[model samples]
Target: MSAIRFEIKLHSCNDRFNNPAVRSPLVVEVDLSGPRLANDLFFVLHDDTTGRTRLSSRLTGLGLAAAVLGELMLIGRVTVELTDGWVGLALVDAAPTGDTLTQTALDHIIAEPSHRFRIWLQFLARTAYTDVAARMTADGLLHPPRGRLSRRRAPVLANTAAWPGGRLNLAIQRRQPLNLQDGVLLGLLVATSGGQLVLWDQNPTYLSASTAALPAPLQELIAQTEAAVADSVISRR
Candidate 1:
């Protein structure tokens, strides 16, 4: 599939912190919208204090790729199709999602509908990392490393630590009900098997309950992604 073109623009915002002090704005519009999976994945993968990410590169790659699929499913651009008892992903729409990475992924699937979820998952996992980082960079969320062996820098949440994943995890940990979007987000994270890594310390039973509570559609999607990740892992082994 061809590349999905990303549009970046400058956006101005005045507030920097909770102190109400106005600071010079350095915001850039990444043109991201509506529960961006890449952003959420980046947030989960990056650690704030040590200025590093805990997830292995392979896990991070697959997790981000699965997040893209979850995003597509959430936006109604794709669905799982059962054909002769065999399940596969089917594209619902071929239109661009404005986010280049998403559109490119859709384009790939549209170009080859016969490809199973595992293939797409592996493809995206290997290829989408650069675009994901690029999006975060455009958003001004990633910070340059102060001093490091590797030049890779950690991402900083602009306003608060409560990113979408954080919020969803928080609600689940607190035994609060999840809305549809949150449910889907949580399902995607669970699929990545990076939920524990993302949320830090949490009870296994509560996590299980949270997963169990997701809607059927989301649960199916999660199952598909988890299978895809497993297949990718096995193929590498």
Candidate 2:
């Protein structure tokens, strides 16, 4: 089948003046595409001053927690996009650290059902901003102590990795049928596999709702793959 694609954008905020009081923001982008497998992205955010690192994963709660922390820490903004068989997430310039809160949230998400993608994304954006604002206040970055700010309506398109020469090992297990909107959740797990995009179909051989309901082009690609695999097996014997 036509290879699926995914992309990621990252932003970071750091103390530029070597003082916790002065923070500078940084932004980055990444893209990945290939066969649907497992563990496609790996993300890390570090607080240089405290030597704290937030290892990111696609666990629903973890993403939200990071977003929340970003808000609290005065981290800028993060944007994620999924389109035409590609998925990507973007962040301003904030260090992401894996902490108890993030881990706990991720665990909770995993235990939940597949219908929570939109909720998770909404939560991520809201919490991250809120956490950043709160953190700024706690760190004396902001005055008057403002509450969580609402996000503007961003574009949501109709929707949509892996690499070698790397040392880290990643495993992605597709335990259930994830709908189009929720597919972006995989991007979170991408952070664990050195930023490699991995998708595991619990029923890899079976057609996904997205696949069964695919456009003609994708359908043709799947047909070609099936034929090719059959040809290979026959020739081997």
Candidate 3:
């Protein structure tokens, strides 16, 4: 396979007025509207230096799985059942989700509606990494790995990859109202170690406010992801 390159129009970050220190909304012209939450989550969690997910593969996979389900909820394809304090995913619609990977996940949920949201996370995490990578690679968000044996997907365009983090940071810092998708992205960031590395300045107020707008199931999804990541860490210790 051949390497592919893409160009992103980014305003000069060197301009004093546009400095990232000011958290100036990244002045980059990229049509990020079409991509799904999991796709943006992948880029947000991907390491620019290593071209790998910033968290352990297991944790990242679970995060990505949550992201995909969150997307389904945002699009009205899925809903959640609340039992006491337990949350389970419920398939609200069987229509095509428009993305095959997301649709596949939806199918799994539809096939087994009895699974807990946490179990769904583990099941989806089993293939979320590669499934999402192939989805992005097909969409051209990922550059093909340099080596035949490597599955690492560096961004095709750095600015495009950086846009997710910039958007989240600006939203939190500026106290801008977040849409459900950004809310889920923010939740996933908090669920994984990505929060410390990406958004070093954690704002509990912003998190509480943002999460308040999310549905109960989605909120529980983030909590389950956090617990799963913590369990992974404990097992590693």
Please name the candidate that would achieve the greatest lDDT relative to the true structure. Answer: 3
Model 1 residue runs over 4 Å out of place are 1-35, 49-51, 144-151, 158-162, 231-237
Backbone clashes under 3 angstroms, per model: 0, 52, 0
Report the candidate with higher lDDT, 2 versus 3.
Answer: 3
List model 3 lDDT by residue over 138-171, tens digit each: 8888887889998798888888888898899988
Q: Which pairs clash in the backbone of model 1?
A: none
Per-residue CA lDDT of model 2 for 1-237, tens digit only, reads: 322232223222322123332122222222213311111111122221221223322232234343332221221222322333332233322333233334433444444424222444445544543343344334343343224563221111111111311212222233345433223323223322212332333333432443443222222223332333344346657
Clashing pairs in 3: none
For residues 47-110, write the lDDT of model 1, one tens digit per residue. 6544366666777777778777766765656766544445557766666777777888888888
**Candidate 1 overall lDDT versus native:** 0.62
For residue 29, what is the lDDT in candidate 1?
A: 24
TM-score of decoy 3: 0.81
The lDDT per prediction is: 0.62, 0.30, 0.75
